[model samples]
Target: MTETVAAIVAAHRAGTVSPAETVARSFARIRAHDDPAIFISLRDEKEAVAEAEALGARKDARHLPLLGVPVGVKDNIDALGLATTAACPAFSYMPSHDATAVARLRAAGAIVVGKTNLDQFATGLVGVRSPYGIPKNPLRGDLIPGGSSTGSGIAVSAGLVPLALGTDTAGSGRVPAMLNNIVGLKPSLGLISTAGLVPACRTLDCVSVFSLTVDDAMTALTAIAGPDGADPYSRNRPLSEMTPFPANLRLGVPRSGQLIFFGDKASEKAYGDTLKRWTALGATLVEFDLEPFYETARLLYEGPWVAERYLVIRNLLASSPEAIHPVTREIIIAGARLSAADTFAALYRLQALRKIAERAFAHIDAVVLPTAPTVYSTAQVLANPLELNSRLGTYTNFVNLLDLCGLALPAAMRPDGAPFGITLLAPAGHDAQLASIGRVFHADTKLPMGARGLPQAPLAPLSANVAAEEIAIAVVGAHLSGMALNGELKGFGGRLLEATSTAPDYRLYALETTPPKPGMLRVQAGSGSSIELEIWALPAAAFGKFVAAIPPPLSIGTIRLADGRGVKGFLVEAADINGARDISAFSGWRAFVAEAAAG
Candidate 1:
């Protein structure tokens, strides 16, 4: 069975395996796989073993999250021993330091194996545009490896490495994962710094993760996600730890007749099956028009954003025009022809489209779409490179353009052996929400990992309590999940920890407010009904702001739960409940609201 990041770390901690052994195993696998196009450069096995030995000697080695795990970096990312080549040899250069994301992974005790191959300058979704030969799709020899993160995807899927970093501007990260039957996590833009990354589209590019499991992908994401002083685009957004799948999850599905499978009935059927699975798992499917998102996707290439891609390779285009791949050069050279007027027109249209996309999410937790419209063979894509590549980005191209985060999960292996996958997308800071739901959905599939059919390890246990950086707040009324004002808590980056009942000593009252609300008040022990509520963890900074926004009688106070745990929550002053009605018999706000709505 292929080792997962968690399994490797646990083995290292138990003294059953050493970092050096893992690093050596990774190299051995690389040689055994024998795919020269999978990596543009590799570190000496001895050098990596030495680094692993050094890491094991550190005092905190046992506590490191990814201790001794090997990671493959996309060639576009700068790693010490590997030259930064965006698959263009003439554009390669040695960096004085590791990229910020790479450095963070190392700090977490990951060993860098080598620089993986990519689409030239990350200019194409099809992995074949690299000057290096196309990486053989681990699942099928004839299929395109899906790129520009081709090598990174193949490395993880082939079990050459447990984790690898890919960069996504327009589906480069996700398209390949679907083709390879692996997990592809495209975190919020700027969550992982681009400081040491070769820019594809400076604004839209994000470092992505490829792993055998959604949990493994998330572990890698947390280790590398953060603000960086060196990266102007990096923001101080707090990444909430994933929680148990929440009840009442509403997933957006494209309106009927809007989905495009390019005549591939197998992919279309697989997607339908995936939606049915999501329904069986208790998610509510809501139909939304996907036209605006498609428009936004078109703007990515049809607009001025191509200028960002060209900006990176302009010097190379000027000095060694022939060195760039013909397909890549053809795509990027168009950037130079776009005028400022064209750029602004697109930006303005994109902003308007973003607003439309936002409205779609107002009722749904996330939009579920096929990772790619369909798969293509290397021969087919090579013959019709540009058009075929554009079709692959059907669902993915709009994500980064609207600043949304995405999680790609392998849904099923098609009848023809092609892998079909689904992606869950949400507004930027809701990465954990996608992960929370995605982990559940992926595990339920019970599919084998990657191309080798390795049995997936058991899902790792999630933290039942809040992290030190967060504060737990109990919501009893409108702030509950699926309630009237639940978006406010979500707006503050709150994550659902658990749905539980309060200790049997709180009295629930319907408050007199414009928008109906419920407030609980403390009573003598064993004298009141047990009021139901949800506990959510909000970032400490956001918690303070959320507390300050409490109006009049509703105030933040200690509320005890059925499990004897106490948390700060909404409470009403006794004096303010004079005109309020006692709703303690209803037990919960949702129940009372449902009863009222039925009338």
Candidate 2:
């Protein structure tokens, strides 16, 4: 369908296609598809085409990044001139303006094709909890589409649109992506303004993007992410420029005891294969306990957070309880019985669990987990709605509670032909980092884009326009991605540049520190081996502060790269190496540590 935003923009710029033509093609596809369950309401073809024609007429159309792109907005978000029903006709409202995120897309020249259906009020992970018919899973009609962003996911997956907006309080954004075979990006909370979104656990809700590729999802994120004065929850975190993944990333996976597949052998094998793929790509997998994270996840539904969901429709639930879905009403009404003490007790427990979750990240660049433990057929989920819906949130509900960002990318297809996906998760503000790795990993799979039958395309090159005041630094040990001190680098807004080796003239030593660190020492020619290292770019202004924070025995100095370039990097003071263990045989800190653990 020529759905990618980049391809459409390039075609327009090359004079091969016009915005009006693209919009017309979008309408034609929607009409041909004829899925009444997909969209609650669609813009009239004439109105959308007229808007596209007007955009094409602008002298600066080329400056608009999303020119001619057609996108679907989840019905929960307000789009001007459309009724915002959130899949519940009883609660529909007409908004005079677009949501801030929607406004940004329009500003970038994206046409709002329609308001897609969702699980009513974003309540269920299963797609069937709505008055509107369930959005059919494009891959197999018998499978549940996955929700609450069901229609948005289906629209993009089926090629009716290349991009769609969704919201993730638990797994709304990611689960649907997995079932549909697409990319879903749940940006760090407060990164994307939620100003016009109807409340659904307001504090945890994030405006998410769904697209055919990691690059496309990222493009939409770039266009929409920012602070909004109107949204008090919005923060001022600027999006980091995209960079290539560092060579030696450490990804955390659940320990064998913690890996749950709900008896689905296909899903189990798919996840295992995906882990092997990550290791093959030069990433180290660290197994960690998932108990604390699971505890945090339990709080989302079992604790007082349900109170927030109830608050969204308190009056309606009281006045017309029968009007809502019976199960949804039961779930929300449970909040009314909770005491204030129960809320505080849950908050206290969450605080303790959050600390444990944060420690899990100290040794990994990100956590790689199955987006959902398993998939379900429509009949299976319908038969056991409550139990199955809770099960779907197994790997997703804890994300917002832990204040993490996640990227869900298609990894492989199961033996049975259903798609399998893995999510890369990191602490808040690491959205771009997840994208950097996800793009490369997704491309490696060579999977088609969703159900469109189009081969995955190469990612667009990262922007070369670096900020003038940036400095590149080479990190060798604890400061490397996914290591103990890695947060210090990320905290200062550092972005990984590359994973390469230093000139074959340095010896590495394990220093005497609490968690241990490595120091690189220059040696005589031909006597040393090329040690693995990673280069990171940080704002020049923050470099001094980072350097000054280094403890004694480790200092910043120039280190030569294999390609004959030099950069400021970590090195050991000559005197400090006296008591340190020479570990040059292992070549890198990760290898040495891994071997030590094995021994």
Candidate 3:
């Protein structure tokens, strides 16, 4: 099999292989693998090959990021030719167009080979809730393949495709990654448009990626991430460039005696070993309270959020109750009984929990947790479905509720032959940060690519130098990644270059604006504390327009970095500081904003 996305693209571009050949090979592998449960519907090989041939004829084919790469999309997301079944036969529909995420992938030169199977309406984490047969777990025949991304995970791990798309609400994305020993990226909510997706939890769902490596997962993410007018929930969360692992990184760990392992000693030891590995990589472990996060996890199914799931298939439930899986129907039916007052009570508690989650990350770069508390056999989960499925979500259920992004990476194959993985999570828009650390950790493991035991490919190189047509600018306050007005920079086609702090000659002040923003002011050398800011590169053609749109009391100026490099950045007028509160002690706008939210 042509293993990684990078290798396949390189071969195609180098004339060693053709796009049509890659597409054909994917279908051949699918037939050879012979896993009926992996894909619910496959594209016509002749049509896909014809499309690939046309793609290769284009002059700009070499420039396409995923040129000729084969991908499998979850059944819930629409693909042009395939029927969107979402694992329920009676609820199937032929979409007029591809889902926004699928459209982006096709635009990036990827070929959609098929729609992978998933739990019915994406309602269960156990994978067996679907009417479709369960995808066989390649690692252990008796072990349950994690879901509702079961088929997507198996597709990548079985070497059928280098990349696949999955949907994540609760643990659908991350749990499957662990069970299959692949990379799963559950991106920030709305980072990828959900316009053509059948909603599981409309408010919390986002498209996810599955691949053999973190870099491969990122390649798929970069091609699809952006705001879409068709998706009201879509956000302009810019994907930043991955940087080398930073020195003195701080990682949050649950306080002692807080982890749940369901009496699986092998999994417990694997998690402990994972923590030790992080320490060896030069990270400082900071302990934090886990009760709040646990409480947030419980609210997903126990509260009104389940109503969102019910809302998606209410018509199907009313028209043909037996058409739905018994377990799925039982769970979603609870949503119908939720009252307005009950919804408000849960919403109020959720808001408070969100604040605590914000503070939880204030002192750490990212938090590491077991992707799943433990592993279960297909027989075990079948016998005790609800409890075991809920247990798998111990670390993942609260992510979307808290508006965070995550990367699930293979940690180790336990002595008992079960796969164990760890997930790195941070507030939304820190996807790049998690990737930076995750890539290094994954390479350190030197694990095989998937169940087939293909040797892991070398890490792909990312360019460190700025492009000639781009101008780099520093943003200190509202325009920092994941901040209130960060979309303004992204809207101008800006890409984050790096995150760094200013020289110890600046002060930050909170300006009294509609939505409070911070301003950075230059002072005498050594007179003030350093302030954190991100450097973003914009096409030189848009630089002038970006600068000219700046409102009064704030303007672009030359700001010096602590590393002795100077760049154009945001600064405040001296007169505006007269009535504003000095916030320089907080170091950066994000930290200050988080502290305020916590209060």
Candidate 4:
């Protein structure tokens, strides 16, 4: 019985064992396992031991959050003194610093034992394309550990670490989790900085979290996440604005006919039975056209995004092509086949498919589907590498391309004892909603954490952009639900509350200006009718920043609502009313804005 992360933390917190003991234990495990393929490099034990003592020696040592927690980082991420190979020896390099995500974790008191192996150039979904051997699935020994995050998944699933960081371009983070029976959280794109990461498909790439429990994954994510100005892709989204999932939530499932299981009867049956469980949990299952999603998925492999990979190591492939793994080299070369026109054509089609995807989400809070259509053995993945790897991405390829966040968790064991799992996908900013409902779905499955019976906590899906700290602010326009600049509220973790009318004392005005601002004036008693506005809960940490984001004329002030409750809502000074037009007759901001759009 190996100690799980929670167990180790509890022991250290209670002084039963020190951080040095934990690191020594981790080194002992690595030595006993002696799987060369599991990690590309292992850190020196003395350095880790010395660092552990220096930290634990402090009188106020408990302040460290992940204090003395040992973690494995994927080799693609640069850990100081560790070589980054991305599984290609020719491409290996030593970075002076750790990746931004890794740095944050270390700062919070997590020690990196070493860099684990990855698929060649982090290109293939199958975890075989490396000079080092593939890591076997920790759950099912004969099965392939999901790659390119293959080893990261295996290390954590094996209880080597409580957590690890993996990059998701085409389900690298999630696919491995499914095979190993763990939690893989691919947050909204741009949620984690890609600055120190070697790009997979730069635009679609996201740094993902892997843990045995959803709670652990969330804890790790909340610690490392936030905008990285260094990485152009990083977005400063809130973690507090995301609200709790309501009971009896609406879930969208692809029309059964649309699911592709790739000839795995066990997987198909496993998925179908899971849906029944979803229904039993008191939720509506909405059937959606998964064709558009499939279309977006196709673009990932067939489209120019492969060129993003080609962009990164063009020189390596051009100079020493022979050094590459045959399958990986073959796939990397495909980017050369794509022309600029082909790239633009794919982009054009993606835009059209995204519109249809919007309609898919309109009727459902989150969509449920397989993390992978099925699983494969290491030998099977090697025999027909291309086709088998492509099959693994059948359900996953669409997520980031469609600008969505996802969480992959084990559901139940397949009849063969291989793990089966599902992913819940939602729009970019709705990460919290997907997690809220996803926790329910995960809880119903009642599986053990990772591959062992560690008495896991029922997962509580973490809201990716929740603003748990801000005051709820009601805004009629510009900050209205799905309106332009609404990101301002989300930036500070503002959550949208119910939309209700204002007290009859307030009069509505559509401010006369370009881009159109709105103002509501409090009138004499009984002179004005109730107007509509949406309440947003903001995280306290983000309130000041949220206020600073508000532009001219509109300001936070006490506004009366229909229910006799007065909260902070948008108010405009009376002096701005001279040119403002009365849009009160149009009712709420939504109606006024829609009419304007139609006009």
Q: What is the C-alpha RMSD of each candidate to the true structure, in Å?
A: 9.4, 11.4, 13.5, 13.4
| Poorest lDDT segment (10 consecutive residues) of candidate 1 | 456-465
Question: TM-score for every candidate vs. truth?
Answer: 0.80, 0.80, 0.79, 0.77
Please, what are the lDDT tens digits per residue for candidate 1 over residues 512-595?
896989879999998999998888999998988988887888888898887556888888889889978999999999999999
| Candidate 3, position 306, lDDT | 96
lDDT of 1: 0.92
> Of 1 and 4, which scores higher on lDDT?
1
Superposition TM-score, candidate 3 onto the true structure: 0.79
> Candidate 4 lDDT, tens digit per residue, 237-337?
97644445576688899886898987889988988898899888887899999998988999998899999888888898889989888898888888988
lDDT of 3 by residue, 218-282 (tens): 88999999999999999988888788788889999999999999899999999999899999999
Shift in Å, residue 467, candidate 3: 9.4
Q: Provide the overall lDDT of each model, using Cα atoms, as 2-decimal numbers.
A: 0.92, 0.90, 0.92, 0.82
TM-score result, candidate 1: 0.80
Question: 518, model 4: CA deviation in Å?
Answer: 47
